[model samples]
Target: MVVSSGPLNPKTASYEFNGISGVLGITFGLPLLCVVLNQMIRPDFYIVGLFTNLDIAELWNHIKPLKWYLTNKELWTYYLTWFGVLALFDVLLPGNTIDGVELRDGTKLPYKINGIALTSTLLATLTVRWQLTKGEMPELQYLYENQTDLCIITVIFAFVMAFFLYAASFIPLAHKNGKETRERILSVSGNTGNPVYDWFIGRELNPRLGPLDLKLFCELRPGLLLWFLINVACLHHHYLATGEVNNAILFVTLAQGFYVFDGVLNEEGCLTMMDITTDGFGYMLAFGDLALVPFTYSLQARYLSVSPITLSRPYLAFLSSTMALGYYIFHSANKQKSDFRQGKLPHLKSIDTKRGTKLLCDGWWGISQHMNYFGDWLISLSWCLATGFQTPLTYYYSLYFAALLVHRQQRDEHLCKIKYGDDWHRYESEVPYKIVPYVY
Candidate 1:
């Protein structure tokens, strides 16, 4: 989801796909993929081996009890409770109000940037609860054991929330002149005149409830915090199962935990990012920020819990270097772009476009148009590699991430081509790479 912030070009903003089929496939396909991946990564299943053996009987036996995965009232309760608490915290917590990028209407919305404080408070509260309960907190192991159910619940919630947002978009704001006007800002790309398509792509640019921006809140808060908690739960589960925690599990837990923490710490950066700046708040984002991110991103840690793999010093060193390099590139490139946008890097080499925007051609942007994407992919690779080569299913994060980033890069480039036209071509010619420098 990390991408460079581009100018708010309404003409460039549109539905990611042209037709209904692509939308339908991803809408239905993603949830199914999540289920399949989670199931295949179980200790008993050898996902790679299943391809060669083709155990239809065993697969059918496993699939027959699909009802078991559906019935988990406790999980539903826990998820709802957690979401509610976070929403409450988002509203009540005190933080600096930062104005976001100027909109098509020439107005900048103010967003509260209290993510770090909220994360700190939430973690402290959870730590106290765990300590006071003497590890008897049912929610701890319950999350790990009923992960499938939790994921299902999250998916359902995303659908419900998306529907609610879509329906809310039509509500009219009462005016003083006995007139009704909808204050909802429609996304240029998402206003496809088709309900289903718009619903999937998100019709509203920024759906809010009072001062709480629903899309922004969801992007940084619930799913990300839950991801870290899930990793912790998996680590605890591993310890409970095997008298001690393995280095592999610990590495993944810490790595992902730090990533989530750092994201929250720099929460203001998201205000200018593509999600908030251009894309509409829809089911695609809701499902991704909620179900896809937490459940799937923590797969490596989850897999380690069931099948622990102790890494040798050599392997650990390699993974450490890989993750470090990825972080360095990702962070530095993003900061460079952000600084350039703010006019803080005037001396840096850039191409002045016809649209009155400067396209960076130096620093990380010089290396690749989307170097941050490559770094992000590398980080994902390290997480999967931490699990060793035991199961191909564990590498799903890196594989899917690569595809997602490539699609995003294509989308960004298409938008830039349309917006900047000849200037974009000149910039591209100068940069000469999309994501991997000479390798690309």
Candidate 2:
């Protein structure tokens, strides 16, 4: 009878890792495995490990002797053993699932996996790909004779495991929730039929286009990631056969995890699934944020691996700093608003003059009503700049993100105007300018 020292409790095997711990484990373990796999298989693909004090060229020159470890067959076997262990542990851990309603006819929907679970599976495949490719694709002759069965089996296994884990965890979660999502939805009353009917009838009369319908669309649903994932698999078959996964594939697999995790943590944005569904454009836009930008624009490694980024390290670092500031502002402002709404913090009225018991306008929100958005744009610019001075495709994502946020802001303003009436206008007057401070 022995007790383990790890976070997982042996007494209750059902226990799992908390959010931060689980994320940290994945972050460290998964990337390390990818790097190790690469080193073992295609040791020629380099790492730019610059210690805080060391210079880049000096470090690269220093590590040149250890390069032989890359081609060692035995090293790869060692790496794969660990990779398999982590991958199995990741799948077996039984993570959180999102259980929403089946809006039509008040039926209960079962637990569908939240985004992080789905994204992890994609990353595992990329890990396998980089391992197999070892940096170069196999010749067609070798593919047919030695490795076709292995490739097929790997692909089928990865797909089946990802799907199985997702279904197993999510279905039960949804079943347990039992129509709560539906109740939240149905509680909001409407008479002009569904969103389509409301759109046609209300367009002429309302002009501003009030809540047309409450029904969340299939396209807007995060479940649509399954479709995008399928398409990616189809378009890149050879990568699987040779284990030479594309650089774009790898970048996207990582970036998507960031997007999904961000959405989950914010939590309020999840409610927006129902909030903006009637706005077909908003729905499309959300899909773009969750899926397209992550998959497409982050394709920098695939296209520009050979190209040189014109920006210097310091400049990029400065840009990254500015972006961090923006995220701080955006996140801080949102936090303040949430606190005020939840009554966790006392609401201050103005920046220079704090009217008792109102929102604190002195911090990030003090600069402007939507200063957070400015910070967001700054951060986005930093990311876009890091992609090198390449074609617009790389930067398009940031641009689209800005446009979407602005549009969302406008929508929020309109909704506030209708709901808050005179209070919104008064609030606007007090907090002049939107997004950028003193500029717009």
Candidate 3:
């Protein structure tokens, strides 16, 4: 489906957030929550009696010193180097070029689909580095040892990048006639006339550095690849501690690794998602892509590294089946919708919207408006379940993801109602569910 118009000017567009209070809450609350969740994953951090006898002093003692947060020079250098390598690979690797959905400006941005190639190259490079250096590389070990520091640095970097992007958005761009203009260039959506809100939500739809699309690159590359790498580090740490690989860590690593691999392999699919097609690049995306994703999403593997669990044959079978089923549903549902949009499934039933877009009502979509979310949730649950309930923190990803998807589904439905009007009501009437068939 085509976009109705270009990005709304931030100066003139309606506010998306509830108000300054809502914006402040998300901007501050999420990062603080991320830090708390990371700390809660520690093996010694007990949560059983916290509510009954909360100790403010004890909690403060657990927090690292201010100097500690400032002193991870090697970790900082390693992160910057990793980002540079990925950026290099993004520019150097050759892949099929796919055009993104048309924006309000009547132009489609061409995106490079070399994520699989980049993933393969990084793996091969790491392997070579290990063999050549006789496994002397301390970077992975550093990642495991100083995860908290790394997370802090990532959050800091996200803030820096967000500020830079927000500032850059106001700079005048030269037009084809060599005249400068402050008008919306591509599609922008986050201008709320409030600096803090705009910074958190984003001011530019697609921020680029020459040919590199920062949002798309971050969405598919660093956070995801680093998430897989963090899992690898945790697996390696577990082996070092126990002198053998356990099925628990192995399962979590491979399961999440597969998810990341699939995402990178099919990176082009993201071009049609809301992140690429709609949301502006800002602190929200930056923090999510850079900090929350790699650090928090790896909680299962991280927890297993410190507190390993042995899965029985039957339990292993169950978890494996769960993951496989989730993957099948998630992948197939998404593919069906994508195909329908591309007009490859002309036989599918759809509701004709007034805006010339068709609301799909067949196949997986017929089951629910977002069957893929159910599948995705299942996958997350399996990951958490593999951790075996040592601490509730390991389940954070699944819980957070479910809430995020539900909120996103609601937001999307609201937009659809506005865009399609009565047609959306008809479509909803026919489908009769949002994310679960015969349930939600």
Candidate 4:
């Protein structure tokens, strides 16, 4: 496996977003985003200026009665349980550590593949619990009630992990030579001179605990599996609140569950993804995977749980088709890209770039530069739509997703252009558009 490395002095050099934007986003922006979401998802009518059109005076009246406390019990039990179980399951479940992309120093990081089992086991457990307690189940309602605690718990965990990783990166690995020590333990991009950025971006590429790859394990399991579990809880909560499960709620649950399932099944595909290959494990990924994904990824479901709504069979059919089309494009595009990398796609091999890497310019790759991103955006839109647009919070998923994809695509193209140089320009000339076919 080619240990893919970035340019020697490439233009798309930043990942920490370390400057003003990076620091603010990590230190302030992320936590604030979750806080606002948690405030908006209250079961009793909550005044959310982000969502509702109520005035400050009206909002003040609503919030004045509420007592504010920061201590979190559910997050500790729930998040820790999930994270601990993930670590345990990674061992109990049968999957070998597959070698990841080759590092620039020629080291192949090994990753364990047990996501499918993890997801399936969680679903089975939820099912059996639900069956055991037809009406006595309390965890679902408790989760919905104490989401704020969950949010805080993850934030604390993410920051603590970030500090520990940053400090640990400085620990000297015993080696024959100083150069070998750096290569084996530290990362190239994240080894920037700045301490603040290094901490945020992560100095070590892959820190492990015993046989466990903490970076890979945290990113894939825990929060992600919890996301599915949360959806299950939301489904239960919705049913408990309302006598029947709304078709819209069911659709969102199934879509999200499928999304998680697909990721687990196609996790090998994830190795080739920019996140796994390019990103460093730090507060960004830590918060995102451990907190953002599990808590906020199910924003639509949370909203629906609070405010139940149902769409017609016809509308449901249309929405299903839209999501399916997006998933089809998403699944197929990734498969094509993966197959091309494996030399299964005959044409892509001939279209070699100057970097000795081949560029795909056919099939879905021929259409949009980031077809998978487009598909993700479309599916995200569908998930938001499942909540029926009563509040702005319902649309938050698709809105944030759009901004995220656009920024990520731009970042990717900038880095790719620097790496591929003129070949990327030529490919851009052929592709022309970024995401949409005819529109920018």
Candidate 5:
């Protein structure tokens, strides 16, 4: 068993059966990796040839776009522009540094808040550049065209960055304090004796170089900003390819853009999430945030770029409504929880738990334990609906996301039970459902 410890406990401790997980992980990862590689290299594979009639000439035509992302040096240079600029954006941009959850040491980490400004800067730059271009917009469309290449490069960056963290964890902190401790060098979970597991799962609770935070840079900047850029690129690419942009893709773009906007604007909610609070930075987060999230989550726009699926006004309205509803629930529920945590919301009374933490039983929490997750699922469904029922590939995200959320809810319940014991049961009775209101 792999143990993930809290702030009070050592980051990671060795478990004897480490080989079991290592083997199981390899067994799962290898096949998934192969699929991703195939999706990248073979232009005919991804979401192609499933619904449309096949022709050799069409397949050859599709191969042209793959070359941009598959082999491009210019795309690699943009990484510096993205990371270097975004770092400054985090610093120079508006918003204050807020404290995170109290750690085992009773210290709260400070996170710089300015996701909204950063997003606005990115979108505004893209728009300005598009308008100033000579003939047609080339920068973003080129970026989108070579998106696969950039994603692969970022994956390489993730691995390299993870290795750097692994190495840095062992390096002593500055000698300024005059007292250097090995425990201080490591995160709560990172000292797991096994190198493979430690590298993959990560050992550091939080790793930093001076004031620069590695995890924060990975989580918010590249993947999310790139995801938004890719959506617009898809819209532009479709216009370039067919000379007509489809309504469904536009709706999908707006829907995804809304989610991304909310993610950036309300990033303060991230301070308490598992990524920041409990999980260490390792290959899992490294690849997930850098490569997996941007490319895979935006597959809807990608699919729409090649094959435009036009939806009726009623269908588009339904999609918009579903996404809107999900966003509302997700936002409201999250704010409710955050307000309760930050010691506000006087109108809502909290249920006092034995563990000293308050339970949210009334308002949105009374509907379902993870009301936000249900909303997210609905949003994912709307993305799939925008692609129509052409191929199962488009629906993959929603299917996987649902499973992931259900599993996460179970894990949360388990942890709550361990922490609060009978108090957890009492809280569960009050909140009832895990994710969905009544069905789940």
Candidate 6:
């Protein structure tokens, strides 16, 4: 039988996990992070902070005829540029703890920091970039007839601002990571033996089947709110305004949304479970909260009927095939990994290598070392392709996803190098490709 700390409920046998620490966490922690970030960066604009309804002049400030045309090209350019920069950072820096060192146990040792200036600089630049690119011409119908509902527009604005504000809350976590790293290096565990919390609530006790191990609420909650906003405030309005239904648009929107939902709810099984499990709650969540979810939502070009190619039934078939192929690869790769981890089937022989390091040289890992990430890229590419090739912006999400996965793969490789050393090199020698087979 397992013994547990903390208080037990009067009626139930389970421990009452709720504590002042958690309540105090969201209460002071949220505001404190915001306040410190505000002081550090002092961003002129809060992406999601609400102001009184924007008058024409205020709206006009964001409107640029030249900018609209450039928007198509500039968005992708910025994305690619950032991708390249991040890739370079990953490769050159190769170490990502911001300040921590890896322990013998492979867990991150965190530091306590009042502030991290590097994050402030990055946030300042990122906020400026986002503001500059927020330009878009109001829809033609809205401009001419004034038919668009102010309520809808207002809601969209509110959502955008709120999303940014919530996202901004994560900025301090970077500092937290830096500080935690310092602490871990300097202090002994006997002094502070607090086990790091998972990214999502209730992550410590959950059972996991695979990488889809992240908590549902932590991952899905934001998306669910966004979906509600989209369906009621955007999609429904668009449908009521336009009689025609675009099945392809509907399918992709729902599919992508569900994919996000699935990821959030399944807290125990993420691509970076190995890393998340090793880090504290703030660190585990900061990346996903600040980047993945926001970017995923931003890719919805449905608001602008934008496509690279014509959104016809014929093109959709190609899109469907792409989606299906990607799905198969991702699912199969995950299945293969799951099977291997479970110590079963043909992979059993691979696991039975003379030298334990030799195990990575065989099975799915043998194919490309990171066959799963290859499948991930395929899935991302297929999703982007489904949007059709009209505006370059449609492809930005996929491109960014590719770069991110590659960046992550490189980081993982570096960590593996430190963790496994020659074993990792030996494994890499056996399986040459990092992501895509024989291509990358």
Clashes of each: 1, 10, 3, 2, 6, 30
lDDT of each: 0.83, 0.40, 0.83, 0.74, 0.73, 0.41
Model 4, global lDDT: 0.74
Model 4 residue 400 CA deviation (Å) reads 0.8
The digit string of per-residue lDDT tens for model 3 on 36-96 reads 7666656566654435644545544556775766686776788899898899899889898
Name the runs in model 4 displaced over 4 angstroms. 1-18, 46-52, 55-75, 174-182, 185-188, 348-350
Tens-digit lDDT track of model 2 for 231-325: 24322443554545443333333344343346533433443342432232221232233234323433333223323244455764576576667
Relative to the true structure, candidate 4 has a C-alpha RMSD (angstroms) of: 3.7
**Judged by TM-score relative to the true structure, which candidate is superior, 1 or 3?**
3
> Over 4 Å off in model 3, which ranges?
1-14, 43-72, 135-137, 175-182, 186-188
Q: What's model 6's lDDT at 230?
A: 37
Candidates arranged by TM-score, highest first: 3, 1, 4, 5, 6, 2
Global CA lDDT computed for model 6: 0.41
Pairs clashing in candidate 5? 10-188, 11-188, 11-189, 12-188, 12-189, 190-203
Clash pairs (backbone) in predicted model 2? 110-174, 111-170, 111-174, 133-243, 323-379, 326-375, 347-358, 347-359, 348-358, 348-359
TM-score of model 2 (CA atoms)? 0.47
Write model 5 residue lDDT over 16-133, tens digit each, in one string.
2245485347535733452353253234554554446434344344333645644656666687677777777777788778887776655666887887778788878877887788
Give lDDT tens digits, candidate 4, residues 330-388. Answer: 88898898888888878652357877878887898888899998998889888887887
| Candidate 1 colliding pairs, count | 1
Instruction: List TM-score per model, in order.
Output: 0.92, 0.47, 0.93, 0.89, 0.85, 0.50
Candidate 5, residue 126: Cα displacement in angstroms equals 0.9
Point to the candidate with the largest TM-score.
3
User: Which residue pairs in candidate 1 collide?
Assistant: 14-189
TM-score-better candidate, 3 vs 4: 3
